[model samples]
Target chain A: MNKTINPLSRQIFIMAFSLLMVYPVLWWLGASLKSNAEMSSPNIFSKNPVWSNYIDGWFAVPNYSFTHFYLNTFTLIGGVLFTTIISCSLAAFAFARLDFPLRKFWFAILLVTLMLPGQVLTVPQYVLYNWFGWINTYLPFYVPHALGSGAGGSFFIFMLVQFMRGIPKELDDSARMDGCSWFRIYWYIMMPLTKPALVTVGIFCFLWNWDDFFGQLLYINSVDKYTINLALKLFIDTQSAMPWGQMLAMSLLSVVPAVIIFFFAQKHFVEGISAGALKG
Target chain B: MNSDITSSSTTIALSRKPKRWESPLAGYLFLMPWIVGILVLVAYPMVMSFYYSLTNYTILDTPEWVGFQNYSEILFEDDTFRQSLKVTLLFVLFAVPFKLLFALVVAMLLNKEIRGLSFYRTMIYFPSLIGGSIAISILWKNIFGKEGFINQLIGIFGFEGKSWINSPDTALATLILLVVWQFGSSMVIFLAGLKQIPLDLYEAASVDGADWFVKFRKITLPMLSPIILFNLVMQTITAFQMFTQAFIITKGGPINSTYVYVMYLYELGFARFQMGYASALAWILLLIIAIATALVFLSSRQWVFYENEGGK
Candidate 1:
């Protein structure tokens, strides 16, 4: 009975601590559904929840609903994922499966780049993009992916390389024996087998791109061109009235897509993170 | 350490010495995108930015090289430069330690074999997923505003709570709290590290009737030191580069208390059109980060445990 007391209290502590950790998120949701008058009440639930806040906040800004922003965000994310997965897999195939010139040298460069912080690249990348007239457009984000430098896409490539190396070479050997070209093997055999790693990379790319506030804020300027993250900021920075309820409502809703994705892909997301940050 | 990353990741089979007909063309095609991206996006800017850092070019005109003038000015003349550095350093000092401490603690808690583990882990990690979004910053503003939930809660006890994110005294602390709240990534890593610690060590400790604290001190911590160092270096670098929350929440004011280094760089590069000056600032930041990283690496040799070296 005395021994049970220790484990019992420990379990209780974990439970209570878990609630404390999650209360802010729940409160965020509840606040989104609360009236302005009821905001200062401090209780998470309102006497009468306002479902209208979502509607009101969705269309808070003029001439454009949050629908446009959500679409824009998805377009950016979809493009990034498509390019990142395709290009990273391509590069990973080269490093992992194929023998090439300067393979070790280039691989070394990628490894060295792992330590170079993104902030160092910001100023010059901005200047170069500006020279190419890419600012205030999605091209700044898109072109990088096509070139295979889409934010941390190189890290994605490195991770995919690691994942690919783990796959049995016998599969590649047999596939080659069956007269499969390198590209075909990479596409059919290697890619299919790397689904878990690809999922990890894809989820992280989505989550990171979704919440990439600074990068988005730097390039995107026109209101019509704004993503959900930029739009939420627009609601506040441009407002004199400062619609706290509407802003909070929109803010809460803005996080849903990312939060939902994360909740679903938590395992892959965590795995991807470790593969990139730790194993490297 | 330089050898650490490449040694593990780059060890691929080189046994297939292909025929001359099996040309390197296809592999180059596979790698072309990254090569092009690196040359165009990464390498070009890195080199040009170094030149830009030496010049006095506003975006309006061609840059004129001024031979280390901008660097010297920042080191000697710039007041905001100094202030922002101070703010950013303080941020790194306080936020990184506290955030890592929470991560280690929470990681230790969840390390125990318990039921419903995933549920707790998910809930704790959820904050970090959305924590960097503008939406979360806006939520933080609401919660810390004068008439926000916090003040309202304290109102019942007849205690006045100041606007936390608005007051210079507490604004940085508010940002630190937010960083600490987003300890999910570090927590996840720490959890992984804890799992890697040999179960036999714990079994042996218990067999000897060693208490939890003593065992954790002698066994767990020493084993986890490498991971701890990694987190410390990574978190410190991240804390230095922190911008979004400060940019949105404070916009670097209530008297520039939150005017962090990145904010200053953004202002110099974009708002003031002093791209040349901003480039110099960015380089200095890189130098500082390099020094800090080196210091951490140097210090690591003393305390960081490597099992290959028989740390025990």
Candidate 2:
């Protein structure tokens, strides 16, 4: 008798596992449209789905709604994405293309910084931000990236450096011979060449900042300035009447943008992620 | 003839011209932002954390010097610290292997020449990309709660189940389960590694009448050991610093059963305003992670394979 697990069984096992794995998200989708009492019924699907969960959850609180939080989140992610891409691209260019003093030293430090846990610096960073009167504002979030520090800029810088290095040095030499300024070469030549990498960095930055509960939770205090993650937490914290349905609805909504981004940008996202692993 | 060539080459190397200085100023100009960032953000904060670790500083007041007090207390007297350390270690122990196992299995399955592989890959990977989010944590809470889906599904088999996340006994396990579910990133890396393995080796093994298990043990394991080591270190480091999911899902809950080290640090720093003690804890955590990483590196020489190291 053949003891081997047939390919059909293997495929079936995988397909079943896939369903089991995705069950939570699918259940979340179902539960979002559920009412409070109905949530405990053990069925995620409601015979009569409460579409009002979306509407009510949109304006869950009196003073603040999910809209304000979504706007705040987008603004924060946008600033971080913009700042990280520019700063990292510039830095990667310098590291990969330019010959300089202490280049190896600085590069080594950057790599070391990559492994250093950001949580270790949180307390001091908070103190510094508080000193600057930057707390309760988005400045605490994006200012680090503006100065080439935040959103895992070190990793992004390293990735872009690897990419920029792969673009033949002759391109830089030719651009220079064409009277292209170093900045122009970086801007016109390397920047265009590094689009795939930049997109990868952007996707990572977006996902991280979007999912960031700790960083944003620590800094932004004002409800009006609350990001989506912060706002979702507030649903449990400040709400005396715990409307599980509306809260789950809002939480599900918060995930949609991220999932959509991942769905569309899957290729670049995988490329960026796998490139780091494979190449490193 | 070889000795004459070597002598000529050494002379040529000795006679090589001195290195000319490149445009250091230009490089500095480009790197100015990162330099300033390091000085102010990374360097300055690190110095201050060390200082704070030595002092009795809360956020509201100046750090009064109480040198070594916090460290001594943490090492000797802190029950919560001890508990959190045990929990974090146990978490790393439980979660990393299971996660890697799941990732390798799925990656291997995905690596097969199957149709809709990308679709399967996407489904498996989708959770990982956003797994760390508060939204997913909330979803996890609902799914594992008393009336959650797991219990509901189990109930269909005529077995009543208790709340996984709510019980102190099962809370840590629930979080570990959550970690295991987010194995997509590692799975992707393993998939890439699987792709890198030459088919000829497997082909040769099969031609020799070797069974699948024999082929896997002899051909695949050695080839994949380096990737396994990579995933191990990365996952271990991540597991050590895990906060958001623990904080959100269980709040280190029922009896502080799931209270990870970082969660403890967060509570100390933010909730209690014990910034000094928190800084000390952070530093200690850093030391722990560094030591753990070093241990992994030390052991890697025995198990981790490199293609060029054949018979050497």
Candidate 3:
């Protein structure tokens, strides 16, 4: 069937299908600048673009704005990224290189957790965090990740371990011959050598945590501490006569960070997905 | 003095003590955080969740031992639990296979020698990266609304457009479409898997005068079976846990048409404060997922082709 179509037609078909696939997003971009009056028209672009929608939407929420939400999200993501990289890398290194009792057992547990669903743990974790007085704070997000127990943390460790294992053990031996401590070798040799994997891990961590609306909604109850996700939901609930343009504007902005990161690290991000899936 | 130093060095050599770097303590130190994490976050919570499933505790009070009452109620008595399960299973049934099929088709299209292949892949895969956000969910909800984008677009063609999301018949379907729309990650995975199939196999098949379908069945299907299994298991597991879209889109509404299992669990635990009952619901979900995953793996024996097995 494809041969009958010929390569030129195939190219055109693929191109057309690709455009159709992203048509919604293109429409979204065009609609963000559309006023509410033009919203029901079905036209993607309007004669007069409403650029003020973004400005108005930024400060639309009273007392706190998208600025606060953005900061909260960043602060939370920053801590999570730091913790996940450090803790998962360490754990991966241990699994990749070190010999210890129950090493297989621990590694097996890590693999199991990789498939374990978050819903199974959410309630008990909520109760646990409540006991520690970490409710309504970013600690729940940070602390679990700091220990490689956050969402997809085991997967990160697994990816890193796979990458680290590819590195020759001879490097560690040479570093040891130079009287470098295990920590020193891990920091100086293993970490730098596993840069590609770490970059992959970091991108995934940022994207997943950034898109973790459910976890954030569960823990963050206060508007002041709301991430961009929570605030968006709040925007919906608070607005009686929903300003389509403003909502679209803010919604567009909400995805901008992810889109920007994705565009810049497009290669690593794609490689990371394929690597994790194929390796597993 | 030289004799004394030589004697001391010999004594030190005779001891043969292990170096600090060689000690197992370093390994333990490196894994300490993860160990603590497993114990505190995963292991403990899992055990507690199981225990809570057996008890009746609403976070405001002490958990009282009820000995399987919650499970019995959910399994035997609760209509909503059954409804939620049915809805969720339906959602999974429709979403996972459709999503995988779509991904595979697109992957095959992109696997060919085409111009701007990377551009196409990037454009197609970008949505999956941020697909889970509340913003996208909101976008979906509105796009399918009565007066929203979809209706307006269809109106241009002179077709009657209803509130697709608010209607019971199409609500779940709309959500499935949303899930399928973000088929980028799976497509990329499939594309990668496709690239791994040796070109010689196809060349040999072509020499045999095998048509496209035969070639796909004999070469592509068998080779890609392992990846299909991977994508299948992963997508099924995720589909079973579908929440944000359902929650925001229909709110499990149009008279509970889209009320998924997690939405029911969320309502029970967070809204009604029936933490114990919700814990029971959660355990059942885990069981369902585990069984579903295991069944897929078990079924793979007949279908999934491992290259190293050499057709034996």
Per-prediction DockQ comes to: 0.58, 0.65, 0.56
Error of 1 at B100 (Å): 1.0
Q: Give the chain A TM-score for each candidate.
A: 0.93, 0.96, 0.97
Shift in Å, residue B134, candidate 2: 1.0
Worst 10 residues of 3 chain B by lDDT: B14-23
Candidate 2, A123-219: lDDT as tens digits: 9999999999999988887789977889588989999998888988898898788888888888888899889888999999999888888888899
Clash count list over all predictions: 0, 0, 0
The interface RMSD value for candidate 2 stands at: 2.0
Best-fitting candidate, scored by lDDT: 3
TM-score of each: 0.94, 0.95, 0.95
lDDT of 3 by residue, B1-312 (tens): 999999999889877865434458989999999999999999999999999999988898999999999999989999999899999999999899999999999999888888899999988887798899988888887788877889988898999899999889999999999999899999999999999999999989888888889889999999999999999999999999999988877889988999999999998888888888999999999999999999999999999888898963
* Fraction of real interface contacts that model 2 preserves: 0.68
Please report, as a residue range, the 10-residue window in candidate 2 chain A with the lowest summed lDDT.
Answer: A1-10
Error of 1 at B102 (Å): 0.9
Residue A251 lDDT (model 2): 88
lDDT of 2 by residue, B1-312 (tens): 999999999888877955454657778878999999999999999999999999999899899999999999999999999999999999999999999999998998888877778888888987897888888888888889888888888998999899999888999999999999999999998988999999999889878888888888888888988889889988998899999989989999879999999999999999999999999999999999999999999998887778886822
Model 3 chain A: weakest 10-residue lDDT segment is A1-10
Could you tell which candidate, 1 or 2, scores higher by DockQ?
Answer: 2
